[model samples]
Target: MAQRLVFPDAYAAADLITFAGRAARAGDGAVHLRASGGTLVTAAAPLLRQGLLDSTPTIIGMRLLPVDPELDCDLVVEAALLQIAHDDAEAVELPETAVPPPLWSAAEVPRSGWSHAGTLDLAVLAERAQWGMSAVAHALPIDPGDLIVQAVRGKIWSAPDEDLGGLPRGVAFVARTLGFIGEDAEDVGVRTCGRWTRLTLRRGHVLLRGPAHLGMTEVRETGHVAALVD
Candidate 1:
């Protein structure tokens, strides 16, 4: 039998599906769903690795949704499949069918012990994200190949910005793309724990692993614990 996510209400279920769809359109189609106890952490990769040696930073857009305390799981599934499952269901339950995601998607961000790094204005984040998007659009040729697109994106997003806590512009790009940063001129929290950095906003969160972070190393060395602390 396929596992299902039982949300508290119809609105919550619909919200998760909508967020998943938005995330898929921004990046790849896969969304990682991990539920434990009363919280369901839904995440999608906005920046991804094209190959094993690809030095691109692993940036993920994540949202925390409420669910029934009894339901617990960890799996990756296609956002489109998730929406289809929701549409076919009669109640506020999301059915899951496992789909393997890219290897880099396996790198987990630390859940606890996040110290407040600093704060960034939402307007700044939005502007940076827009700039990166525009840069990629202007640099890509008409009908560009997949490799070329990835290369251009990697170069643009991976470059660090000293003004934004020395984080890559991709961080802002992911936050904006995932709809985490809103039109309000409020400041968002930046937190850090070990090699993981989290941008906390009212709508959702964006988790990022440092450039040196690798999926295989975390899986093998930490026994899949994803503890990348030095």
Candidate 2:
């Protein structure tokens, strides 16, 4: 089961508001913005007019069903604030009202394993590298491949083409973007939590190791590899 997130006051206002706007435009229903007393004074009016704010500002004894229940409420709130900052409301607030327990439980809660943590895909990473390299290519003489390797963290693992999703027990690439020791013209060492199995790759191969296994295609689309057992 995924864990439940109790939104803080900061999230309640800013993030919720932003999400409200996007959802409203998409016809996904309004995001409920609840508050008490004077907190909603300036905040509630504009949001209400935009139809982003729920007409009712009191969830005192009500329950909520988050579509992405496992999503970090804070992140959603942050996204919302980023979206609505240009609007009339400069700040968001949470009233002193009480919130009710969840009326309906989510089908599944987000898990707390390395496999469930955030990761990036090669393509997105490549795009980021392209953007960064474009910006500093003149000042810094570097290779795109080097930049991509530098961007990735932890360990990299590879598998036999047939056993891609099978159990992993092999040496993998270990690159460090943070706390980089020095700059040199040498391939970084590969590390792994398990033993190595004989596997063949084409000419060049990058080893990835985590409690997950993500393919190039999946990464390009979803931004990360598939999570596997640790």
TM-score against native, each model? 0.83, 0.21
lDDT for each residue of candidate 1 in 67-115, tens digit (9 for 90 to 100) = 7888788878777766424353423344445787667568766757766
* C-alpha RMSD values across all candidates: 7.5, 18.8
* Model 1: CA > 4 A from native: 1-3, 84-96, 211-230
lDDT of 2: 0.25
User: Taking the tens digit of each residue's C-alpha lDDT, what string does model 2 give over 133-229?
Assistant: 3443444445556334322211121222212233221211111111111232222221123322111111111233233333322211222222211
Report how far off residue 180 is in candidate 1 (Å). Answer: 0.6
Task: Give the Cα error of residue 159 in candidate 1, in Å.
Answer: 0.8
Top-scoring candidate (TM-score): 1
